[model samples]
Every structure is written in C-alpha cells, then in structure tokens.
Target: MTLPDTPEQTPLTADTVLRYHLCWKHRDLDGVMALYHPDIQYHDFFQNRVLGFDELRDYVRASLPHAAGEDIVHSDRIRVDGCTAFIQYQVTVQGGDGLVAFQSSEAITVKDGLIWRINEYATLVRRNAKGSDRSSPRPATSRLGLSPRQLSTMAQDLEHYFQRQRPYLDPELDLQQVAEASGYSRNQISYLLNQVLGQSFYRYVNQARLQHLLASLDDSCTRMPVDDLAFAAGFNSLSAFYKCFREHTGLSPKAYVKQISLRART
Candidate 1:
C-alpha cells in the first residue's frame, strides 16, 4: 500500500516516473537505482516475485533494453493519480514475427521524491487457444522469476541457439539437454516455450526438425528418401514425421516431393 498523498503530489510523482522511464529506456542502471526508495518493493505478479532494493539491481539490469529496437510498445500514456503513477505496455516475443506478445502494466508509488513501491502485472497474449475460435491474453504463470522483457530475450536466444547449433538434428535431443546447453533451467525454458510461445517442448523441436528436412528437400541434387530425411532431421518415428510434415505443408510427403520436382522441371 502507498502512503496517502493529496493532489499536490501528482506533479512530483509524474516527474519521478518520467525520469525512471527514461533511465530504463537508456539502460541506465545507476540512474534507476537512484530513483528507487531504499525501502522499495517491486511486485511482479506474472512471475510471482516480490523484490527489494538490493534484489532490484539485478532485476532491472536484466530488464533494461541493452540493445536498440527492443519490442516494447507503450499501450497507453502514463497517468498519475496523487502519489501513484500508472504505466502500461506490451512486449512482443521475439522470433515469432510479432505473433505473440505480453501485455504488462506497472503501478509505481512515489514517496519522498523517490519510488516507494511497484505493483507489476503481465499476461501472455495467446495467438490461438484450444477449443476456442478467438485469441486473447491469459494470466501467465512463471516461478522462474522472469519478467516479460526477459522472456522476450529468452525467445530470441532460443531461436538463435536453434539456428546456430542445429541441436534439433540430434534424434536423442530432449528438453533437459536444451536447458543445460542453453544456460537456463528446464522450468525457465519450459515456461518460455509453453507459456509465451504457446507450444510444447517436443512440438517446438519437431517444428525445427521439419524445417530442416524441408530445407534439404530444396536441393535438387539431394537423393535421400523422404522418410530417411525425416529420421536424419531428428524425427524418431515415421508417423510423427508425417504428421508434423502434413501439418506444416498441408500435403503428403510424396505429393510435396512431386510438387518440388515439378517446379524444378519447369
């Protein structure tokens, strides 16, 4: 709860929060720390974390946009009421072409010219949900203590890891191996894949495998059978491979190959 202040405190609260926002935009750690009240508490509802001053340094550092062109888009202008200010924004998950994003809001309470408390809430915007014809944001859960911004970074990192390492090419690969190699805990990776990306771990891996196989099929000189290529691309079973392939290409493997051959002949 915030200390009660009259309308006279509105200007001060707005100024302080504007500065805090600029500090975050510029990736200024010390500037952000300077604005925080020593007894400040940051509550992240999405991750269920309640952080203090000392803990906030690392949290803020991880959240600040270190690189230009971060995906955060402000949904509304800052609105201040007495001693508290409100900010709302959305962070688009990377590597999905903006198909997925999280809507986040922050309620900052100012006290004695510094930030006293924060109540942060975020929800994952689902592009598609089972048994529903429409999409919407849901109450996201994360025990891994990752903020929405950090989850966006995690998405980018996972995509980069898949592209550069080609780990999906290993038929024996599992979520645990990815968690270990990617420098994240299984729960963290799982949260990113399931909560934010809206896909199971195995489904993500199979999608990568399918992409790999399709890329190989583009080579006219390649002569491997489709089933063999599927196994080589890390599918453990033919049925699984065919299902993934058809889901992606909307055609049977033989028909897809025939179409590619037709295009080449033309």
Candidate 2:
C-alpha cells in the first residue's frame, strides 16, 4: 500500500530506511507492515520462505516476539543509491536472560514513495546463553561435550528408533540401552532427553507407553484387564503404571474408561 501524500512521504532514501528500522525497534508492527507495498515480496533465506504481504504479516507476527528488542538497531551508516537503499545494522535480542547479537543488512527497492521489495540477511555475531559478556568465549564443550547440532541429531535418531522399533515395549528398557541402540554416548542421550526434549529418559519412554495404552483403551471392546494392558505397554511395576497413567490422563484408568464410555454412549 502507498503512504499518504504528505511532506513526510519522501522518495526512498536513507531516512526511509531509518524509519523502517525505528518501526522494528519500537515493535510497531502496524508501522512496519504499512511500509510494504501492496504487492511486496519478502524472502527469508535462512527459513527458505517466500511470501506476499498476507503471509508475511502472519510470519512476522509469529516471529517478531522472539526477535524484537529495544535500541537494537545500529543506524550510523546506510547507503542509498538511486531508488534502492542498502542498510547495515546490528540487532541485540534477548533470549531468556541472555543476549544474542545479530549483524544484519537489508536491501530495499522503493517504487512510488513506498517500499516495494525487501531482501534481508542476518548473521549471528554473538550468543550468550548464560547472560555473560564478551569477556569469556562461548564454551566449546557446552552441554557436556555435545554440540547443539549433535544433540538435535541424537534426539531425532532416538525418536525415529523408538517409533520404528517400539523399544519402549520392553519393560526393562533403559537409557543405556537406548544410547547403545541409537549409537550416541550415554551422556549425549541423557542430555538429548533431559535438556532438549525437556523430560527424563524414563518419562519420555513412559509417555510413549501411555499413548500405546490410550490406543488400547480406545478399543472399548477389548476384554483385557487394565493391569495386563499396562504390563503389555511396558510397565514392569503396578506403582509405575498407576503413576504414569494418572499423570498422563489426569484420571485413574477406571475414570478414563468411564469417561470414554459415556462419550461413546452420548
């Protein structure tokens, strides 16, 4: 969309780029979006996403909160050539209590006093996960010697193996066995589950077991006892089964069965 015809609506220049950066810095999504042409095309290389204004708005809405920050832009230098402006800036965003600095630039094509096209690139300059300063380097041995990529890959591999082999069906299944089977070190496996997946190894396995138990429950015609069913789903002890069942369903097996039964009848 075009800007209102006013003295403030100058042709594309360094000032226009500064205004755009200000809109982002102030978290003024409306102002930020208004700068785009009605036929604007935005491309994000890292996400490999290309979209028009409608989809662009939705993407920005979802992603801005994660990336937005105050006084984050460096506007000391900007290059303007013809109808195109190239802007260089650094943005510092808060990730938890830590700060992440991204060196960024954008190329804008202006048509008829409005921003028509924008191509942006961002590079991670520094990441401080512990709210530390530049005095110390990011740990090379973070997460107990496992890099973020390695942990992510291990987590994926573990999930894939469990889904395909249903290894949690073995009541005695444990983290060490998972580590061996998944070909990741035991510590790496533990980190993948506890840190990345946000659950203990047993808890992750038990959640899968709970899903299996629920599927069996869905077949209301099954005559199998709940305890037997729990055993078949990899619960070696009655206490573990009861605890996991209550946590997962927020109801006892009997209550769950009754609830589903009533729903079926209704």
In order, what lDDT does every prediction score? 0.86, 0.65
lDDT of 2 by residue, 54-110 (tens): 876665553343233332466556667766778776554321123434455778877
Clashing pairs in 1: none
Each prediction's RMSD to truth = 3.2, 14.0
Model 2, backbone clash pairs (residues 3+ apart or across chains), number: 1
Candidate 2 Cα errors over 4 Å, as ranges: 1-145
TM-score list, all predictions: 0.84, 0.48
Tell me the tens digit of each residue's lDDT in model 1 across 1-266. Answer: 54768899999999999999998888899999999999999998877889999999999887887577788899999999999999999888865423788888999999999999999987767554353323455635666778889888888778889999999999999999999999989988887877677678889999989989999999888899999999999999999999988888889999999999999899
The whole-model C-alpha lDDT of candidate 2 against the native structure comes to 0.65
